[model samples]
Target chain A: MNKILSTVVLMALVVVGCVRQDESVIRIGAAGPMTGDQSKMGIDLRNGVELAVSEWNEKGGVLGKKIQLVPGDDQADPKQAVSIANKFINQKVAAVVGHWNSNCSINASTYYHTANIVAISPASTNPRLTQQGYKTIFRVCGTDDQQGGVAAEFVLKTLKPKRLAIVHDNTTYGKGLADFFKQVIENKVQVVYYDGIQTKDPDYKAVLTLIKEKKPDVYFFGGVYPEAGRLVRQAKEVGMAIPMVTGDGVYDPTFISIAGNAAEGTYVTFGKDPSGLPTSKAFNEKYTAKFGAPGPYSVYAYDAANIILTAMQKTGTTEGTAVAAYITKNSFPGAFGDISFDKNGDVTKAPYVVWKVTDGKFVEMK
Target chain B: MFTQQLINGLALGAVYALIALGYTMVYGILQLINFAHGEVYMLGAYLGIIVLGVLTYWGLTAYSLVLSLLVTVIVSMAFCAAYGAVIERVAYRPLRNAATLTPLISAVGMSIVLQNFVMLAQGKEYKNMPPKLPTEGFNLLGANVSPVQIFILTASILMMVALQLFVAKTRLGKAMRATSQDRVMAGLVGININQVISTTFMIGSSLAAVAGVMVTLYYGVVHFSMGYSAGLKAFTAAVLGGIGSIPGAMLGGFMLGLIENFGASYLSSAYKDAFAFLVLIITLILRPSGLFGQKAMDKV
Candidate 1:
């Protein structure tokens, strides 16, 4: 009797394992520079996917099975990103959620294409990302063109400054945004003092000095917050505060810490609206309850994750091709708003909100 | 603009000098370049920011800055000193007689471990440093002189002077210098080589703590990975001046900083790091022994 019971238990265990192995649950791989200089973006991006996947699994995951999210860190290097992509493909993941930067994503895109897998990016905004119009490439966030148009419109109408000076850090994202914003707003405003600063440099006093010489009515920075913060604080110290404006890239709490009081009058353009959106109220409450502090990018990240899950639900399949097709063909409501992708898999809903650094916080400007 | 760049480079070079001291000192004695030196700098900054953040959160506004700075130095130095000594005994001591690359690999591993440890303790977000030495500027020589910059330079100088005195006047200082000159000879002369090595590591790590604190005060922010960039720059400074010479290390750091600032201001700001390394390459090709290092007769 004891031997019989043992065999029965063994059979039950084997059946359970076999059932688990048969369907091959929705396994998604995410990669980013989670352990290097530009790691914050990867960490933030993973947090979005993690929060979404965990929630999906708890709610009886896609196709009636658990979802597994495999994370690989690229450490922000282009070479590392490609290697990570090959690893993800080897694992036969249903989809991939990474390569945060354009360089990394661009390198990994070919690998994902070859593997017959769809790669969704939450952050990489270079226009060249989906220019090939690959069936598998999708981006949840607006591209530099969308963001630049919004910024140009804001600079043209809201601020209405007579002259505009653009400074970029010369990265793919930075230079792209600067060039697009310059082209759009150059006719509307007097363009002066166009320049590029390096990211690793600790000082920008000369650039600030040149801007002072040009004395544009407004200075628009197309770079990350690290350099922007230095420029902002130094500009204030040297008394060149002509209402410095920046893009969505520098719209984080780090800027406030870096620039201090000088950041108070600064403005940045981003797609997400905080405290102004009626639809995001529920998300804001849940997010604040879970995370102690509320960073600006959480909403977009959550939206990206939720939209991915919603796409999976729509197709009723974890197959990358089917899901990607469904995602581009339909619209879905996410924490940010309704997300609908264009033919090139870019988010069609383009809305830019202006935020002012009021009292060391990103307060809604309009 | 030149004056501002010069001053900025000087200030930045001073910070690198303090860190390079640790790298230079450890390399001088053990010939083991502690890869975790950057992590020590990072840990020090994090400790300062965390302590001050807690103080501010607890509403201890009056003495927050002074108290946090004092505590940050003590705690960070204590932790890093222990880390350095233990790392030497466990990671390096086993491979003491092994090929040089073995110890270098161990040091690199130690760096990875420390970075990951710091990441887990402090989330990946950038922490805001407490307000210290207010962001007020005084115009001097047509450059907007930050009183804050003045404080940074003065404080860094005092720390270096104090460090120099510690090495020159203290009992352990002579032993360390003796060991660096010739470890086996010092051991034969009735001095404990291990003790001297431990002492050197302790001193280098302690200096890194001071650098970490000052940098946070300067940047008004700290990140877990802040040490990597600063550490690379400082290591370059150490090599640029002279790998084993203290004064050379200091000179290298200041020179690197000046090059970076001048390059950023006059040349391309985006290529500042490239410019710094270009200078190093030029220097290495021209003077392999560094600015102050003496060229020795070839054994051949």
Candidate 2:
């Protein structure tokens, strides 16, 4: 019994000493909705960072040292994200790669800034995060305006629907995307209506009723799947004669299951076509082999992780300042595409891809 | 749009009524609120999700929704009822002889503990009941209403009617009312107050289970922390309707729902919560017994 207790004590001591304050192991912090509505995003970010670490460690880690990925669940709550940011600072992590929601990333940015910690987000698209001019912040994804511009141009120049109704969740991403779509399409097409919905309330029939009344040829929702699916079904019931469209947040299996046949004609935006892209085929095989499901943000997260590891290798330091400098200075090939952060922490004018939901598969728009 | 808002309100009201019934039943008897009651409601949602996941894993989607919902309801009720009884025995019963504030504080602690337990187990993910409740809308007087709304209303009314009949006719129901009225008198009369209280928990927890499943079916997914927000809303509904009255709780729930829906449509959607509480405050000020509450003031 004495030997067993001593052995247990020794193991605990070794583990504690392993994570010593001055250890070479670089701790990378990632914050996302690990348990809530945007869990897929968090899962994707987790998988991406995990794969990046494994790949980097396999090829000899940055500066001849191992990399440790630290993930914090923010549950997509802005306050929780802020709290996690403070925790990350207290933990003295080298860098952070996280936060899909703009609201979360925005709140977490101030903390990373205060601590001079380098932060890289894979999918927070709100322009304000960049416009805030926080030097510590970086993003792998484009802003709402850029996404809207690409999507709006494609819609007008390609699909050419007669009348389009725009809707949003009235949050940073939702409202930002809706406003950009509105600005881009108002001159080119007959914009029918702009509406905003709440987060928790179950019904969207009123909006659907209004949509049916307006008889818009097309409907675009700047929100996630839970609300979008309801809107789609309610529109069909109320006989809303419109093809539904959405931002990237709506491209999930949940949307198809909820809307069922109503989801057939829906169009959504994507950063890359999962099948057509080289990374998609590779990541698809690996992810299916590993997690059994190819989560929507998996590739983007994989690329974000890849970028951080590549920067760590180039800078020869897991130090935030060094990594950020190397990341901004260098363009690295990623799962989605070649990624290089501009001064404002976003991909320099990347275009968004449009995908149509057909038979529950993301068929790339021709 | 006004009619549409009213219909939406009625559907929401039914949901609030069912949830409030669970709370009011417990409060009516023990005067000790089971804060973990919401967690039980949340557990019911998780039960439904787990059942669906298992069924989906086994390719049981071909099974009718009625059958699936039935399984969900039974499993959720069983789980929550067990949890409710355990919570009462362990948390509330310990503080039975303590001051009134002691039990209330213990209830709050239990609520936090239960919520955190769920958070630890499920993480911080926002889960829904599943499939985002049926999207089919039925027309009501030139206004569109979802089948989910109709489903919630019909099921809740049926539950209320059944509860009323049970409490009026059943021997156990009479014991429950007796105990609720005077625990000492009922105990002297050989009512077995313990059994009455346990039965009260069983009934209330079962109602919460039904509400839990209905909420998930209505929203289409279940999350771990969904109980906290919705539970608070339902508690407000109970208080608004008169905490001790069954029918009043139901009426208050519907009224709160209607007010929230209309407030969202015409006023700010963000302020819908504000409107719900506003209704509660106004009711407290004007008619404290609630819209359907029966006043039986007694002085010892």
lDDT per prediction? 0.78, 0.77
Residue A347's lDDT within candidate 1 is 85
- Give TM-score values for chain A, per-prediction: 0.86, 0.89
| Residue pairs with clashing backbones, model 1 | A198-B269, A198-B270
Cα lDDT tens digits, model 2, A1-366, are 999999999999988866766677777787788866666678777887777677778887777888788889998789999988998887788788888788899999988988888888888888898778887688887788887887788788777888888888877888888898889899878987777777755556545655566667787888887678777765665557578778877877877776766778788887766556775677778777877786777677777777777777777766677777788888888666677778878888566788898986667786
* lDDT score at residue A251, model 1, on the 0-100 scale: 81
DockQ of each: 0.46, 0.27
Which ranges in model 1 have alpha carbons more than 4 Å from their true place? A1-23, A36-44, A54-60, A187-192, A200-214, A226-231, A234-239, A272-319, B50-83, B162-172, B295-300
Best by DockQ: 1
In candidate 2, clashing pairs total 15
Residue-wise C-alpha lDDT for candidate 1, range A1-366, written one tens digit per residue = 999999999999988865654345777777776875466667767776777787889899887878888888998777998899988876667788876777778889888887778888877777888887688888877788888888888888878988778899887778888998998998878997787887755456656765776779998888777778878876865568699878877887878877777788898887666455777777767666766454555566667667767877878876767878888899878656678999888888767778888888887775
Q: What are the fnat scores of the candidates, in the order listed?
A: 0.42, 0.18
RMSD of each: 6.0, 5.3
10 residues in a row with least lDDT, candidate 2 chain A: A201-210
